[model samples]
Target: MGLLIGVGVLVLIALYFIGIYNSLVRARNEARNGWSQIDVQLKRRHDLIPNLVETVKGYAAHEKETLEAVIQARSAAVGAKTPGEAGKAEGMLGMALGNLFALSERYPDLKANENFLSLQEELSATENRIGFARQAYNDAATIYNNKREVFPANLISGGFEKAELFEIEIAAEREVPKVEF
Candidate 1:
């Protein structure tokens, strides 16, 4: 009877470890899927940029510096391999794109152009999607990180590394300032 009781307790401990391990695996995969969604949105945003730049180029020939900055930022963003690198590059691209748009305000005809308007709308929509994807990715990473750090799960997570959250390095770039007259 003593031996049987000891064996039963051992089995329960093994099962508990197995359950925790499985949960860790699932959480890690969820985080990867979340990052993949963000990557897809970023790719869409990158693809739309060239068309948008070209449309603006036709009207703002003298604004070569702004256009080149946008192109360079786009290249950096497209080349980023990791989430952190991508976040930084994307932030730079966003700033460059903002400057381009500000320059466009000077060109009345460019603002009125149908192609430009359509491309601008599409880019705006893609930016929104990217924002949502980033949030989801961060949420997934947080869940995985918490699980890895928790008591029982932490003991079982010896083999699994903590997932990194997608973070924006430039906090100032993330905010818009209000202008009061």
Candidate 2:
């Protein structure tokens, strides 16, 4: 009877550890999926940028400095390999885009152009999607970080990768951009 009871206890302990390992795996996968969602939205944003720059270029050829800044910012954003790098690059891109829009306010005809208007609307919608995706990624990272740091889970979490939250690193980027047409 004593030997049978010891074997049963060992089985239960093994099952408990397995459960913890599985939970850790699930949380890590969720965090990864969340980051993937953000990447998809960012890709859409990247694809739209050149079209926007070209449309603006037709009207504001003399605004070479502003246009080039936008292009360069977009390139940096596309090349960013980590969440921290991406946040900084994207913040710069957002500021550059805001500058481009504010510059448009100076030209009455460009603001009214149908193609420009369509692009602006599409960009605005994509921005909203990006915002949501960023939020989701942050939430998932928080959850995974919590799971890994908790008492019992910490013992086996040594194999798990840490997730970094995507943050807007610029104070200026936090402000509501003026969207006047």
RMSD of 2: 2.5
lDDT tens string, model 2, 22-71? 98899899999998897898789889989999999899899999999999
Off by over 4 Å in 1: 81-87, 167-181
- The C-alpha local distance difference test score for the whole of candidate 1 amounts to 0.81
As a whole number from 0 to 100, the lDDT of residue 122 in candidate 2 is 77
RMSD in order of candidates: 3.2, 2.5
TM-score of every model? 0.83, 0.83
lDDT of each: 0.81, 0.84
lDDT string for model 1 (9-114, tens) is 9999999989988999999999999989977987998999899989998999889999999999999998988867877888898888878777777899999999
